[model samples]
Target: MHKNKNIKAITSFPALKGRLKQLTLCALSGALLLSVSACSEQASQTPEQAKADFEAAYNSISTERLKNDIRVLSSDEFEGRLPTTEGETKTLDFLTAGFTEAGFKPGNGDSFFQQVDLMQITADPDMTLRIGENEFVYKVNMVASSKREVPSIELSESPIVFLGYGVNAPEYDWNDYDQVDVSGKTVIVLVNDPGFAAADSGKFQGSTMTYYGRWSYKYEEASRQGADAVFIVHETAPASYGWSVVANSWSGPQYGLVSPDQGQSRVKVEGWLSRDAAIKVFADAGLDFDQEKEKALQGPYSQALDLSASVTVNNSIEKSKSYNVFASLPGSELPDEHIIYTAHWDHLGKDETKDGDQIYNGAHDNATGTAAIIEMARAFASLEVAPKRTISMLVVTAEEQGLLGSKYYAENPIIPLDKTVANINMDAMNILGPTKDVSVVGMGKSELESYLEKAATNQGRVLTQEDRPEAGYYYRSDHFSFAKLGVPALYAKGGSQPINDEIAQYRKRMNVIVTGCYHQVCDQFRETWNFEGITEDTQLLFEVGYDLANTSDWPQWNATSEFQR
Candidate 1:
């Protein structure tokens, strides 16, 4: 059973001002100050005094507090914390109170909420895809949806073209759509990049998937090629998950930022086809899937199959507002420069069609990360004096919906990209016991990783790369939004190595949780789950951000990184 804390109602502007005034009379005030005497006092402290001050603040991150917050947020009453719903309202209120309690002022001007206007399109499940004489059912062999905010979208026997991986990377000198006009046609693409298929060190980054391998890039490139519809053939090993992940993720109400032309710039239809169904389609065209894939690895490949695809998507569209919640511990000296921490605050909402459990309580998926941010705020607030640069915490919405909220923030930023020092993102935190090593997602992307390594070293833990680099977990999260725009972003957590031999059992359980319950209804808060690992990871991130905030240095992306400015 979960217990919801009876948090006080959100403080009004006048009351908030009074609270700030009262806090200013005390040490380490919550209010943002440009030139406070407390800054001088903090600067005057000896090294020993400063270390004691840091320890006091760092030790304030309580595992019990994090556990309770996750329990409350992931409870059924939150309705899976979906954006633009009653769940969103409750989540906003809860976060507003949490930020207030943590002594953080609104990062956005006079408001904690940054309203992100979105177009929500829920597609009808009762749809069919016809490939010549063969027919495939929705959620069975195929899952497709239209980004275009229209009542219905249809394709009538559009010519099908196999466009290899559908990647147009100029740096790699690879373009599958080269000399091929896919205008007004449907295209079939393979998941991941040719690097994974070829397994050759010279191709792309060998097994390490690049941004070109992402499905979003595929859809975007197809749109640029004027393709009416595009479908990626899904394979479990390359895509890193089962067909259920695609089916469950795409079947829901999809959200995109409100566009001027109602997403007309995007392809009319985009989705995935099960590998089995794709093989059948290839066979129908008198082609073998394995043989074609092998040929695709050699170089650019495209062929006009003798099949035509026809499908229609009936969508229920609603124009509404979701929010990116922001709260900050402003700097005393360099208020303009900011060190931002981000975590997504959304998950798959309730599904009425399911038998008993319908809510996707995304406890491990994000609740742990969100809770850690709130705790980090408290740690910052407990400092003897504010950091030199502002510490901003942003909890974005609709991350489960293709990172819409963060994308909106990145495109329309409150803090200028040039002024932003670094972005530390937390997602799906470790819930098993502590580990001897910390894992860096998309390692070697930026210099911000060095700070993480230093922090991990202080904790007696080493740094390691993610076990599954081929999964492309980097592009799948909110940090990718910042990285794409040149800001250095770090996403790391407890690596797989257990702290001691006694915790081997927890590691086995973690594997089961990550593989079995991801994006499913079973992703609920478990009482047996350990919070020590998440707590340590939170502290490590806090140390990194805290160090960055106090220093004048701005970490940049590695020269070899694709996201380099």
Candidate 2:
């Protein structure tokens, strides 16, 4: 018998009162009925038995084991787990060992590793920008594009065009590229969509950023137009984060696909400039940066300013190799078909600036997520009845580096695309506390919603929409890579409301975890971590994978979804 005393609630608050009452009544009623239904008392189990089985599996997930793994992975010794470093070897070895111990067979036959060839471009920190004798150093104001390391590129005194949102969506009948030729010059644009500015705002989906509004889209569009360079002006509200975050994020070594079939990205240089620095650049050219930004926000606006600027970026490029660890549990009936569970194993690596502390040990960001998959593998392996389809447990690399691992996997899948049913991705699990609902990041975008609804229902939970859609989190994760290829991918939700607490306070605490610990050193493990929520989340995910693995149904894309058509 499992000990109930070990499963005490971590905190006591008011919001859990209703949920506790409901759970108690349901359990009691269920137990009584289950007791009566047993024709032979020895042959039947009570409702508590079922719940207890789930809880035992949940509680069996040792937070200490998770913490120990994280402690080593994130410790300075691991060197931030950056690809092409000693840490990569250590991380991969650790993951493979864990999978082997969990009884998962080699996913890629004869090997547990998937070799990903990549190009690493490390740019010089001392890049110089000069616009007709008006010069500004790189770090102080602007950063160059990640595409290539050009020692020096001259920009002929060309006109600077202001394009609204810089998006072209024929479906929405909106195009920032309409009536504008940005060839041979730089284009200035805003971050996110106009809806973000006013909610009911612009020609584009008001505050919600369309694909065109994404910075990556803007750079691609500029490249297609044969523009010299692209500069995106950064603001917190519109961009969803501060300039410091962007600067620190892009300053490190970046990764890109190194396949024979990959097409060239258009723009030679693509990057961002701080609002203050942009103001100075505009001022030097005798143009008003604020006015230009405001005009760019309005629809169908286009203007050319003679802001002749020249930038010289000096950097070194190197090619390196990364690995995506894979393991599988083959199904009984449809052995070839698969349902993938993905979690990124890489983090920011090490930053020497933080005194003696260095390793990024992505515990909550993904180590927790990775561990969840391992536990799920254990659960599925324990089932008496084997699934009808194969289950692939994928730990991708370079997610923090820009979803390179997943993107690589999508382009070159070990399993054919058509046979792959759904990609269930776990980026960061909720370590906070249990809540009334599980939040879906990109809610209502696909048929995966229906699948999640069924899974949540089984756990006595409900599905909820993302709390901050403006953040554009759906486009930020490894799942988006698979989604881009028309694969139905599900990113599972973590605990939001505490098992016993005020909903508002729980929300506040949740935000703190996302903002403060998300990409920081403070994300390390704790002795006080209840792991109750982790256990619940892990069990819920196993149920989802089990359902997908056993059922013959193919999860489809929603009709309204952009990927469906």
Candidate 3:
């Protein structure tokens, strides 16, 4: 996203400066006039007339095709579509072929791929957490990873400190690092902010889990404090996930963008310890973990513990190039302005260390979302008229790896951000059936909500905001990357309505997938999935985009939105 550049006036005389200023104002006014005229012309288009053929093309999106795509993508052949793997090549080829078949042209200078450089780090730690003389085994007691650039980590007898939430928000008049000389030591931090612990939503964005609550923040704060290592004590409730989810995700091939300084500014190691392990470690230093934790969060408090630990990590690093797939339908009027659709095409690759089924197929996790976008692309191509603004479908990689692909695109957008109208991001859409309501995550943040609501209403559906704000879903998806740059984005899922009357059934199925199959090898394609829901969800997306396309009105973030310019 390019920032606005200031233009200076050229003056040859004392009176010329004022005259030049007048001329510049006139030019700017003329430009504004042209822009407003164009906007009015486009915004005046009859929605009913423009969308007359929209339903037809949207109907052309076949349930069978979507199902077939998901089936293959989540199958054993693609190897979970991990970035920088054989599976990546196959996935990219599949998306490109689909785009070609759907009347889309190559978006990146006659190439469908935009190369993204990424680095993979797998930590094989010969680690032991020693509290005085008592030693605990790694992985079982604690699992560690690193963002540092080095190949290995060695920290022996580093003293420990307990910092509640590990937040340093001067705005909130709080600093956990206050009165601490933490140089070259380790910091033991809590998982989430006090908002969750206090069961008070009014505290720290009201149980919404501010950025300070994230474990990544803990590590970064520790680094800023010049700590050698950071270990976050994990509690399922505050973390909003089970410890196994942490173990599975952090233990394998961890990834990060190629840092400019090769991550030298980062702490040597970052990890998590189970509550029991944390208790034992604290107790070994003649302190009770639970009691200390209560005091730590009491404000204006921090403790330099007598506890010390040591570990050594041997890392296997691999650097490679992956891609974000861009397929475009050139605009009939405004070729430079764009409406972007993004879905991640990558999932966690096969974990051979697992027993039998090794691949984390990510069927409902994201394969379904990727398939939906392809079907949407096909639908847009089948439309009677080309959109007024370019419509691009982007299948990004490494979303499961903490939104790496999307972050890269945000930093290096193929198109200028100011010219980009809006982004529609789909991840793990509804596979249950049709619904009377459509769900929008971060619903109130932008004008796109009105567009989405109108489109959903036309289809006899209501709009629903995210039910669980505590999960902080708006910050977790690829859409956040665009939103952070002040681009109006709608991050949606199929949650508002379900066709089936058995209310408990949908939740049961979803819970089973979430708790058991999410990020696990069991997330394979299922024969029982009903694609009608996702198909309808895709239709809603198409209609909303159609509404945006015929109108030149650029959506803007609401005044209350954090990303508002």
Best by TM-score: 1
Better of 1 and 2 by TM-score: 1
Report the number of the highest-lDDT candidate.
1
Per-residue lDDT over 37-63 for candidate 1, one digit per residue giving the tens place of the 0 to 100 score: 224334556779768877888889999
Query: What does the lDDT come to for candidate 1?
Result: 0.85
Q: At residue 163, what lDDT does model 1 achieve? A: 90
2 or 3, greater by lDDT: 3
Least accurate 10 contiguous residues by lDDT in model 2: 1-10
Higher TM-score: candidate 1 or 3? 1
Better of 2 and 3 by TM-score: 2
Error of 1 at 465 (Å): 1.9
TM-score of each: 0.87, 0.80, 0.80
| Residues 316-410, model 3: lDDT tens digits | 77676778988888776887889999999988777777788878788987899999999988888876667778888888977877788888988
Compared with the true structure, model 3 gives a TM-score of: 0.80
Clash-forming residue pairs, model 1 = none
lDDT of 3: 0.77
Stretches of model 2 off by over 4 angstroms after superposition? 1-79, 131-136, 149-152, 201-205, 259-264, 276-301, 351-354, 502-515
Tens-place lDDT digits, model 2, residues 1-565: 0000001112222221232111110124445532111011224335576455545544466655655665566666766666656667677777777776655777777577787776655666776666556666665667775475344445556567767677766655667789788888888777887667767654545555555567877887888887878888888888888877777656655556674633244565677877887777777667787787677666656666566666655555656677898888767668789999998887776666668655566677777787777777766654333466888898998787678899999999999889999998887777666666788887777777777788788778888877777777778889988988989988767645555655446557656655666666677755545555666677677777767876789988765455665
